[model samples]
Target: MPNPCFSPALAIPAMMAALLCISTGARAELGGTMSSEANSIAAAPQTLLNGALRLRTVTDAGNTTINEYATNTGQIIAYTWQGPTMPDLRALLGRYAGSYLTGAAALAPDGNLHASRVARPDVIVESGGPMRGYAGRAWLPAALPPGVTASDFH
Candidate 1:
């Protein structure tokens, strides 16, 4: 007897592709469109706040708040995150996380990884935590919209 629940369309290759999409969808970041970034924030418990300049704020799990700055074209140009715990950098920084790690590795080793700010040509990340208190922000310099200052993040 054949299994009715099993179909060739749902085979390992197809399943792999689906899984790939799901994983990749969870890592949207700066330079991605707002629609594409939605899935990343959906994984966290968040409250949306609308503001001027088409800006959108998403307060995620814990005290983390992510400010997404979009261009006139509605594409996400930059993102800022701050909270009691550092939100997932892999999800927030996307491809830029690797560069962050590389920068961090070259730090002065002052025993303050969280307190240090890692800067790369493309991505800039700042993090600091004292026990349960943590705060951080990451942004893509090249992607930031014109006249959008870094101070706008907080």
Candidate 2:
């Protein structure tokens, strides 16, 4: 029997509380000891963090932010880094891509995750660290406008 006094506001909070309780009890079954880094990474947005997208990034003098966006599950939206020069962005992402995920994951340096996106790897970015306000090189895809090109697609 449905409660006559139930409201959307009440239902939402109650449902959330129930879900939380269920998940908390199930953690042991999932099987893993918690670590500070793992917790942070898990808690941090898989798509966004502190106003920055996960994979897209822009850097200043002391910090860099990598951000990427997603909707529902599929159809990804990319991020853009503001660069003083195209080459600078390219160099940043070039090093970043080549050194970070690819080296560890051993994947290709595939920049510009989207059809309209552009990225380069300039430095080896650590997977776990203090994010945001970090300076980084710019990233503008493999086929940048005018004179820029990937050069080595081998």
Candidate 3:
């Protein structure tokens, strides 16, 4: 007799459930108030743009360095990352995740999976890199502070 645990029907549903759990457990912070989740994962915060923005740097287990930029009011407005792996968009984008997914899907295939850009009126995400060195940035245009521009994120 075959083992029921190895059955394909059971495995498929189990995988789906695992994915759902993973996604739901991830929190979105973009456009949201500062939360302990960010602080818990990052080192000491640094002020930037002449005190117009706050930057938190964190190195994940994967050795990826992620920099989150927030306003003085504690609202995260942008993120820049570089490492061997890409950061979780679903978690970083918060309410704008759906817009990114839709825009990315609509992009014309350039035959280069290593680079992609989503530029909508509300959000702009540019990510690309080779196998072991990835870099990207995601920011909210409307949330940028006075005299601050997208180039300042990098």
Q: Which candidate is the best by TM-score?
A: 3
Candidate number that wins on lDDT, 2 or 3: 3
What C-alpha lDDT, on a 0 to 100 scale, does residue 76 get in candidate 3?
89
Candidate 3's clash total is: 0
Q: Lowest-scoring 10 consecutive residues by lDDT in candidate 3?
A: 1-10
Choose the strongest candidate by lDDT. Answer: 3
Candidate achieving higher TM-score, 1 or 2? 1
Candidate 1 residue-wise lDDT, 36-84, digit = tens: 2345344322222333234566766656776666665565555666666
When 1 and 3 are scored with TM-score, the better candidate is 3
Every candidate's lDDT: 0.54, 0.25, 0.68
Cα deviation at 100, candidate 3, in Å, is: 0.1
Model 2 stretches with alpha carbons more than 4 Å out: 1-43, 46-62, 82-154
TM-scores for all predictions? 0.64, 0.19, 0.78
Ranking by lDDT: 3, 1, 2
lDDT of 2 by residue, 73-113 (tens): 22223222222311122222322333333333333323312
For model 2 the TM-score comes to 0.19
